[model samples]
Target: MAPGGPELLLIVGIAVLLFGAQKIPALARSIGESAGQFKKGQAQVEQELEEIKPDASGAGSAGAGTDAETDLES
Candidate 1:
């Protein structure tokens, strides 16, 4: 009566056998910390984007003003 993937059940059985139930809580806490760190990094990147000032031309397009003739003549 396996409801989901067999791989997950197999891994869980192995973990319970090797580490027992006592160590699982500590392992889960460590995983939670890793997940929190990932989320914090994602938030910092989004905050940096919001803090950035848009260019004066207002289109927010880089390499917009370069002219081929001016560049070639120089």
Candidate 2:
């Protein structure tokens, strides 16, 4: 469920009281920066996963050389 107007206002008021007016802007800025970094990291991980997905699906079809190689090594 989502918060209503009153609940949001109450939370904002509490934050203001806890952090003070002067610090609020700085806190907001830091929170925004952190969110941006989190999103960037999430995108990077998704891209890497996409890059590996095709290779993973084709691995089995690449043939039995892998097994033969392992046997030779032993």
Candidate 3:
């Protein structure tokens, strides 16, 4: 009834009883590591997108079409 589910609360209570005061720092360290990894991955993805961005002169065509094709004999 606490919104997370009875099984989750039971597990959390068991963990607290077992670890007491010694596990809080370790859990926080693990959460920090996860957050740092997520941010690093997000930054790398954004950098890659910026690198592939096209210019305003239309020279960065990504295989859509070429303007010189209309004058060819084909």
Question: Model 1: per-residue lDDT, tens digit, 1-69?
Answer: 545788889889999999999999899899999999999999999887766746444563445455655
**TM-score, cand. 2 vs. native:** 0.77
Query: Which portions of model 2 show Cα errors greater than 4 Å?
Result: 61-74
Residue range 1-74, candidate 3, lDDT tens digits: 55468888888788788878689679879999999999999999998877766553356463335545654646
- What is the lDDT of every predicted structure here? 0.81, 0.93, 0.76
The ten-residue window of minimal lDDT in model 3 covers 55-64
Q: Residue 54 in model 3: shift from native, Å?
A: 2.7
Better of 1 and 3 by lDDT: 1
TM-score for each predicted model, relative to the true structure = 0.56, 0.77, 0.49
Per-residue CA lDDT of candidate 2, range 1-74, in tens?
98899999999999999999999999999999999999999999999999999899787756677888889999
Kindly give the stretch of ten consecutive residues in candidate 2 with the minimal lDDT sum: 57-66
The C-alpha stretches of model 3 lying farther than 4 A from their native spots are 1-19, 55-74
Least lDDT summed over 10 consecutive residues: which range in candidate 1?
A: 55-64
Q: What's the distance in Å from true for residue 18, model 3? A: 8.5
